[model samples]
Target: MKRTIKATFMAAMVGMSALGAEAADYKQNPFTLVYDGAIAKNEPGKVNIHPVTYRLNGLNIAANVYTPANYDPAKKYPAVVVAHPNGGVKEQVAGLYAQRLAEQGYITVAADAAYQGASEGQPRNVDKPANRIEDIHGMADFISQYAGVDQQRLGLLGICGGGGYSLAAAQTDKRFKALATLSMFNSGRVRRNGYVDSQLETILQRLQQASAARAQESAGGEVLYAGDANLTDEQIAKLPFALYRQGYEYYWKTYAHPNSTFKYTMSSLLDLMRFDATNQIELIDKPLLMIAGSKADSLYMSKEAFPKASGTQDKELFLLDGATHIETYWVPEYVDAAMGKLTTFYARTL
Candidate 1:
């Protein structure tokens, strides 16, 4: 078991190295989007995509704003800010949901988180909770000022790890009137305790390694990273967790994007190890909707976090029967079902 774990980490590092060797051309696609049914070109009478960039904490955040068909800036419209999964770009699942919500007559914006995707940051792919939460707030800030947006009607949808951060952000940032999470993965819990508490015994050891990595950085030593891998089909299939196995196929295969990568600086674990999405979850007093696949190996995350949101009386937990964690990202039937719930939820709440 130890050997297998070591091999997995090594493979991830190899994959990250290869990914870093190539420069990501955000314009590779016509609209720089990788999802299916993405807009090839904007038309006058359809849900149109507008590529946008705005300053967030001195960093340029790359985002896409989708306007509903026949959308007139002269008229007010509800808006939703979609946050992508960890290691995901704005052009993947987030863009898909943004486009779908726009078709539902709501303006939606999806942005690449700082230090990941097309956004500006150093030591790329720094997966810190504070930064991730701030990205959501930044999205809300940008969208609130957009034409035709009703600030009072703002809603939020966070997928995977973003969902956890959204929970943290909405706790104190009450600008969001409604909040929702899909396949929420608690990055802090997983990092500190390992997936499903599998690494509970190594908590101190990992922290020591992170501390050493930070010390090395402070001394101008070689920078180290974690979570990079180049696993083969066999390795991926052998992964113990359904979330990791299917996540490999989704991010590295079917929905691959140049800007998306799993690696983060080893020192980031210092901050990540201490963060918890549910630490102050009760602060979220707004209406909340938490959705997850009944069969998802990671479903426990949402199940655990949902009940902690005691500040809101208006909350619901919806399950997608037979869907896995990754399937909820792109599977047609599951996506449709989730969109239905989201549309209805936003309409009623926002």
Candidate 2:
């Protein structure tokens, strides 16, 4: 009996180890930097983005750098690091924001988080928390060394899920003097608990179902992409949540970029529930700016993160009354406000 028990214990230990490896599979890739992806043929005043690679905990993550028109190599300039939304690429709104900011005289770098986009990784779109946080710091280290880059005056901006990582990055890294987000998604709050002040509770069972999804995968099955974007008119009408129609416009058709993957791992949502970037907001110690549509479903996320930030005297939260989540990302009126605040911010902080 004793011998049988020992063998069973060892088997269980091995199983646990394999499980841990799958959970953190993205931590081992090399960081890829594109020093000169496009220098010879960039339109004047247009945001010129180049592929950049950097190292963090030994991963070779990828990024795109957007320099302003007439960027003089001799003069120092402020820079912004943009983190894209979940399941988004460097070519998404993050890149758009970077280009716009660069046009306004700030240097910007929009990066693809590890295991997604063109970045290096296996089992893509895994959505690990540490990988996402590390990607932000890696961008910071890379841009701080550019010829005209001013290391002291740096800022970070995240959209959707990127907003949570930006908050996580600012919590520990002082490199960012100013931080902002558009429709900041509190991934953990939404995962472990339901959306908006715990409105959609009973998330624990959802996770258990995801675990079953992995078992299905282990048995030579296919991955299932959750979320129903193809809802009929009646389905759309039934959704009590606001901004989903707007979400479809941005993520599906309008402003939709080709690089984003329509499906990410259902299992990754497990890690998302455990994520809590806003937990240590009091430790951020920088200027915090939160922007979102007043009617957006994710508005409460921005509001929650802003107040918890410690020594956050320099913070400002902007709510566009009639706007929804996607509106702030690319709409003309909302973009103008963002442009003004962003330019003024780097100008003042840098």
Candidate 3:
């Protein structure tokens, strides 16, 4: 009884109470968000952001346009459409990269995924493979019509899961002059096959649970978690999985709004099983840049896609020596290399 009481006391010290529809303090979990990442909007140059909506596969998508600091609004500039990672927003890495690329003299527009963000969709945060791919093509059309954008010189950059979606998009959309993916994740393959082929044991079980959850949803039950974290030490030890730390130190801690905590229905993985980014990589003929960190577990996904790409001469794969997946998203040294390569690629391709 003494030992039991001691364990309870220790647990209480680290336990946190979560309020619904708000930011979660994850430090207690050691792998979750404890603080916030609130960054002031500083568009270095003549950055004009216009909030717009465009139709994507049946969903009305949200997008933000960044015109360069040097933007005259009177002259056309090369344009890049930046896609966010899975479960991310236009205000995250995609937005930062978009704004910076615009500051570097390109017209950059970053868009949120259909249901999860400040966009229109039903049953929010539903991760559908086809919908995501169609959203990319729709984004191309949207950015091409912006006042200072040159549609013919259009390029697309996808980060994390978005990178894979970009590959799916480029397979059919010929308008994308160049393509780039950062820390690209093969969501579909990972979902169906497990990360690095390690967790196949649970695919069937997970699928079964997802099916049951779908039925419950049809019965009008609110979506919730079946196997998510409860801030237990055991949970933290299990995270930092698949090149992702269980936490968001660099992005969320430095750029998150005090009140913004985004989450998805726990069962969204059901559809994720179908979203493979490398199914037809060989179909993409544009200049392709696949950038990843040598240390990332996801690096293999890019390496796999590179060799299968049809545009061997038009493609390049760059690995940052000691960085991890998230580090490349906003870490200065990593971001610089990414921006530098992007600048050069767009200048030549666009």
Best by lDDT: 1
lDDT of 1: 0.84
Among all windows of ten consecutive residues in candidate 1, which has the lowest summed lDDT?
12-21
lDDT of 2 by residue, 1-350 (tens): 32232222111111100100111111121222111122334666565666778765656777878788877779988899999877667765676688788888888998888877777776666676777888888889889997789898899998887888899988999999999887787766765665554435456677887788778867878764444124454543343444444444344444444445544566766676688978877988888888887877778788777878866788889887776676676666777777787777667766
Q: Which segments of model 2 are wrong by more than 4 Å?
A: 1-41, 44-47, 53-60, 197-201, 214-225, 228-238
lDDT of 3 by residue, 163-185 (tens): 88899899879999899998887
Which residue runs of candidate 1 sit more than 4 Å off their true CA positions? 1-28
TM-score of every model versus the real structure? 0.93, 0.80, 0.81
Instruction: Give the lowest summed-lDDT range of ten residues in model 2.
Output: 13-22
**Order of candidates by TM-score, top first?**
1, 3, 2
Instruction: For candidate 3, give the lDDT of residue 218.
Output: 76
- Give the CA lDDT, 0 to 100, for residue 9 in model 2: 18
Backbone clashes in model 2: 12
Worst window of 10 by summed lDDT in candidate 3:
10-19
Tens-place lDDT per residue, model 1, 293-346, is: 898877889999989999999999999998878778777888899999998999
lDDT of 3 at 203: 76
**CA deviation > 4 Å runs, candidate 3:** 1-45, 57-59, 224-242, 250-252, 257-263
